[model samples]
Target: MKSLDRKFTLWALAWPIFMELFLQTLLGTVDTLSVSQISDGAVAVVGLSNHLFSAMMTLFMVVASGAGILIAQRIGSQREEDARSLAMLSLKVCGVIGLVLSVFLYTQPGLIAQWLNVPEALIPLAESYIAIAGAGMVFTALSAVLGTALRSTGNTKAPMVVGVVINIVHVALNYAFIFGAFGFPEWGLAGVAVSTLVSKLLGTAILYFIFIEAFHRRIGWKELARYWDRSLLKEVLHIGWPLGINMSAWVLTQLVIYVFLATLGVKELAAKTYMNTLESFCFTLGYAVALALQIQVAHLFGAGRTRDAYKATYKALWIGLAVVTVNALLLFSLGRQLLGIFTDDAQVIAIGISLLGLNLILQPGKMLNMALTNALNAVGDTRYTMVISFVCMWLVATGGSYVLGLHWGWGIVGVYICMIADEYIRGILCLYRWRGQKYLRQAEAEPALGVGLSAREQELVQA
Candidate 1:
């Protein structure tokens, strides 16, 4: 591919993934906004459920990230058949994992809520929301894997279209069920959960039709049962497990931080929830660009163009920083208005607005960390990435938050300060890792010919 041509490829790959993240964030925003109409307790319940959900979703990311790397490499090497097989195997494995997770969470949601130290008044709402969402774990897994597969093949538009459609459906359903509008029941928080599950299941079905049947890339149940490729499965697990564990650990740290904050009381808990909602919108730009970089850099690395990979990484990093900076400014300018959208409570809005200004400090460090980590993982340097993540989240974010925020009685803002410090520390570390020569060495450790693509298939990757 020409140098200029690769730039187009980067945008083509990144934009749809970016839209997907944006839509997902929009869906969350809509969910929170709609639920806030019920009560602040309703918003808090959804917020707590989302924190738990993030940890649960990490399992799917484990598979999706691993499968994406393998698919990108196979496509790069011109191994179409192996790429297809890996995609099929990933669906089966993720399905089983999702089933296990759904069962576990559904059966013991109250127990899970208890562990989170969720407020007694909100525990029932939280448990109800989680149980319903957990039941749809299989659909969530399928949507994530199929979307990643499409992205791996340079077919970003299909996933973006599907995500937008599903998000629209999600928002409409949320409005109807939350308010009993349009002949729907006023199910409140339960309605939100039902809408989420239904939307995800529909998304999975749509993706299956588009990617599998329409594209003639479908891998059926028979294939999954009869053609279990042990070696391919091992390759995916080797690459995917660390990444999954890394994500799971990272989310668990956030949950622990939430738990620490719970010790401060409901007002503090409610403030944290509103701030996170606002932060989600602010961080969407970085998250979207980071995702795009992961796919773009994966293609470059798989094509054995290390120089091009580095260039793409730097370009993406700069772009992410610019995007995040703008978002921070927007938040600073409109912080109170955004907070008011979530709650009419004057005190919650006041605390949330104060927290929003501090987000300007937090967002840039997080943007850098997110972009570099995704870039590194795209090149298969996941083990080191995982180790670094484990250390920072455990030592600085979680441990330090406990000491400074809770132990010192700094309250919600104190916890936010600790979070900012953690992001900067990890951001600098990831930047240093990308700059060093060691990343290439880690990439070299993976097998070059494991997937066995053909020349034309490889050219498709470079193109």
Candidate 2:
């Protein structure tokens, strides 16, 4: 009865999701800031390794993302049992996927660094950092899956609370290990990686405790024992594979752009690293809104409130665009001060400032894509979004970055210009698809579960 417990409006849902994502992004920024003290080369190598890990992180989402959607719809349809089963199933699947990716990262760190074409001088540090940090992928995967389950229930606050703890501990560990503070050895990059691994492990454990305590309370471990569900797993994969691939394509495209920057030199890569950290603040606004919107829309769709679901995404999209416009402007105005916090190098500061300026135009387009693609996914329209992402990311972003930045010698500036084009191109296509409203036609495929006392309870607890 307590399984599908919470109701959410956009703001109620989004702010906590924003805080959680902000904390996660801050963790990455904190790592870069700490390593910036060592050398620009250190920042560059660590960034490369992080990109590789991130690309693999998308693979974990293949299961978590799909399962989250399934759980949300099932709960909306009043299928409490199915919703709980999907949550357990996601944890098992993500754990296995995470373990496999972890081993790959640990064993092939050097090879991946080479594939990224990182400078020879940076490869050794990158390899070591990757192995240590990558070994913890399982913890992150578990944390993510647990968070996905909670979010589907509209309980964003739990994950946000856990994130706050993870960030604090990670910062303290980084200081002790990176600088010999608290009598810890100054392990530098290795210390940073270890701190990350420890924090993620703690996050996973806490999230698991919360999951069992909150959702599986009556049954507890007995509920956890209800794991395998191949037919359900297939349904999740049916919805998720395109999404996972789409997510990977986006991250890989960003990494490819970084690779182009790496070809220019470590300075360029370091500059972009700072740029990315700063840019994360802008994207988080839209991403948080989009995620919250997806949960709300899925519930609405499952309840057969088709018109309300359609209106929700559009309403949220405009609001997201306005907020990000302000965020991007504020970030650009304080660009020098922010870049200064990361490094003392004037060139890096100058280059980072330039990217921040371009982001004024870039942020809106990115918001558009996040808002629409997520809304589309909420209605089970995954394949169309995936195809557009594949086309726009590679042909427009990747190829253009190479031709403009490398071949044309226009440098990071040209690469960024092309990047802006990629975002808008995808944004426009997403707009067109959402307008078509084919999702309405597909709604009958996933009808609601039979109504009961629990469904009446949910109706009484309105958003």
The top-ranked prediction according to TM-score is 2
How far in Å is the alpha carbon of 236 misplaced in model 2?
Answer: 0.3
lDDT value for candidate 2? 0.86
TM-score of 1: 0.92
Q: Which candidate number maximizes lDDT?
A: 2
Candidate 2 lDDT tens digits, 30-90: 9999999889999998888788778989988999999888787777777767788788888
Candidates in order, TM-scores: namely 0.92, 0.93
Per-residue alpha-carbon lDDT of candidate 1 for residues 220-292, written as tens digits (9 for 90 to 100): 6576567677777777878888898889988999888888877776666778887877787787867878887
Per-model RMSD to reference: 3.9, 4.8
lDDT of each: 0.80, 0.86
Candidate 2 wrong stretches, greater than 4 Å: 1-6, 216-219, 222-226, 444-463
Candidate 2 C-alpha error for residue 2, in Å = 23
- C-alpha lDDT of residue 94 in model 2: 91
